[model samples]
Target: MTEADFLQLPDLAARSLGGAVVYANDEFFASRENLISPGAPDFDPSEFGHKGKVYDGWETRRRREPGHDFAVVRLGVPGVVEGVVIDTAWFTGNYPPYASVDGVNLEGYPTYQELLDAAWEPVLDRVALKGDAANAFVVDDDRPWTHLRLNIFPDGGVARFRVHGHARPDPAFLTGTIDLAALENGGDVVACSNRFYSSPRNIIGLGRSRHMGEGWENARRRDGGNDYVVIRLAGQGCVDHVEIDTSYFVGNAPGSARLSGIPNGDAMSDEPSWVELVPRTALLPDCRHRFRVDSPTPVEFVRLDVYPDGGIARLRVNGRLI
Candidate 1:
């Protein structure tokens, strides 16, 4: 899948990141929360409730009325919708035959009633869906969205609903210095040298690492080279300080790390000229190391290099936007 595809982009409605299924027309057989579950759907043939077979997805009662069923989801972060996935795994006989998606942008916290009253624009028109399979649809809209409404023709079960897109941080909220390398702020790990065990993207995710699994980890390097990940900042900024955390990785943390930055639109060529923001410094396992940057250059990208390659729970580049 390409970067623009919803399957490749981050889920903006992930419950783990403060997203919520605000309202659903009906959920007789399954809960609406299941639609944004991070894990894959599971099945047990014998598992059945009074309503019907218990599925790991959103399942409404069989349509008896004239209208369709719908669910409203508040995005974890406002972003531009690029793609969507209406997964119907394990929902063969009871999956929705067709679906459509709509989005809306609103500021501040809004009530469910307010969301229902808002004017929602179409992200995906009505389209046919396959049973027991991931139904992916590419969206072309670039408008930032804060909420989404998924409409299912003639109510049925849907294993999961994933909305993927690029984060568009509000400039008003970015008044003070902040972590320019944060995922919620729009920073992304565009490229990495290695991701054998875990994804480098995790390092920039929201909040501190809960465990080693939530951080970036790579295989032990046998050769004499280092490991690195390049991150595109949410916007150009003058980096002030940096933090490298190795929490929960007591035994396999990098010994040292270095940080570099470059302006946006510059070619990231082999051995590209990188301005050293933080010199090679020693790191401790299960601890947080903070350093002040001496450079004052405005940069749109940052690269973190770990000596000899090991796990790094998180990397924070604190700065003020330029």
Candidate 2:
């Protein structure tokens, strides 16, 4: 894959999706919590604190001995990571010169001590890094991992850590009717016509978006056509219900929407490849539109089309796996 092709995959370590930095060896300069912020790191050259210049990232004190600095992260959606991104934005001088990553799998939440003693395997070996840049690495391990350990040479700051992969939720919790288009259920947005304001993948995120920025918003359309997003389902299933949430999108919600699916198909072709699940219907701003669908044909993919283009908070295709 290309250097950034992995970005198309879901980020299982997003704070918005429940990820957290469980532990850190030290954070005398900046808090470790900043490493997982959902938004990009912020900066203010004139912003200084009692310690030194304030930084929006995890910054440990310079080591005095022969050890290094490290932090542990609990992935929101336990999955086999395909790639990693160590973003050290705005940390030009204090960014880590090199870093490595390791991962571990466990049944339930392990105590801090137990996690420290687990047989963590290396996912990405030590690699050089440039300050104020997002370092990307594609790993080879395919085993599902629940946690990750980041090791920085000696000590320094890091803005963010992204684990890109698909979710591997426990099968027990996936029983009964479930959202076939949920990121936590292994579904992912594969393609989209526009993502100028926000990522189309956000529509598959859990719950209603807190604001317009949390959902997918395309730029104003000039091309006579509309906006659309294609999703690969968690598994082959017949859609039973659908939820289109436009919460917090007061003035920019889509005027109307249509849902279509491809039964017994593994790929997306032209419109002829899809069967109508929900016909184009009018939509209101900041409202939840729930529709009962009786699709009997098992589908592997689904598509949502918005007329002329606008914002969409969340899309749920509920069904049972066949």
Candidate 3:
């Protein structure tokens, strides 16, 4: 699949885009506390609310609805929606068999299986759509969905569901045709370098380019006499390790660079996983620099947080840019 097919604005990104509250359930609408609204444009519907809404005794079971049941959310803009991720922290209601999108009416049965069985029906526009049953979101093939309807079989209490997928121009009759043919005929597979982040900011590294804001500066150390060179990771990731290279510059024979954790919630855990620095050696008092993470865990992103007791220059990753 092309990058457009695999990475056209992930489901999480779509949910982040600010928009109007197209629709909500009348039975149990989420409190305005954390819900994103026109007035509070920056608010995230999933987190940080004044007062949380509560549902009664339904906590013991999940609700499942079967007929004419579903939640529909309409996006503000018409773009290639790639995927959807539903943060159902409150999905104590029911479990849905599946969800479907209805941009066009079915001439035969009301369900997807029936549409496949109707031989007399005209071919429908096959839009890209995907659903994350576990996460409670529906991702679609790149297509424009002005109105999205989620059909949930009546089960019980489902907190939230999201749809994912990007809106693309009509699937060309000739576009994926060539690629599809190549796959059938036998073609070499290709791999891509994925980008990620680490640390508290969850900084994302766009790529090895200047587009990612990068700069270096020298800072005086608390030790009083030495300074250190610092390079911040574009963004944090599940940083298992970091390899730094400082061979190009001369007159920089440093001892070591202390790895520090930036506290963002539990990131700076007092537990052993707090920060693992490789090459367990003292910071070079004065010299060049290079290092890596001793042992690390998955991180949203990380800053190349450094502490240089002495002045130095140049920093680069040692292994894959995980």
The model with the greatest lDDT is 2
Q: How high is each candidate's TM-score?
A: 0.95, 0.95, 0.32
Deviation in Å, model 2, residue 30 alpha carbon: 1.0
TM-score of 1: 0.95
Weakest 10 consecutive residues, lDDT, candidate 1?
1-10
Residues 1-322, model 3: lDDT tens digits = 3434543332322233322223333333343112222111222335642334343211112334434343334443334444443333444323333334443222222343443332321112222222222342233354454444433334233334333343321233223112110111111112111112111111111112121112122333455353322223322333333434333222333345544333232433355234444433554422334454544443322223343422222233332223
Scanning candidate 2 in windows of ten residues, the lowest lDDT window is 264-273
Which parts of model 1 are misplaced by more than 4 Å? 1-6
Candidate 3 differs from the real structure by a C-alpha RMSD in angstroms, to one decimal, of 16.9
The local lDDT score (0 to 100) that residue 66 gets in candidate 2 is: 92
* Model 2, runs deviating above 4 Å: none
Structure candidate 1, residue pairs in collision: none
Q: What lDDT does candidate 2 reach at residue 52? A: 94
Clashes of each: 0, 0, 76
CA RMSD of all predictions: 1.7, 1.6, 16.9
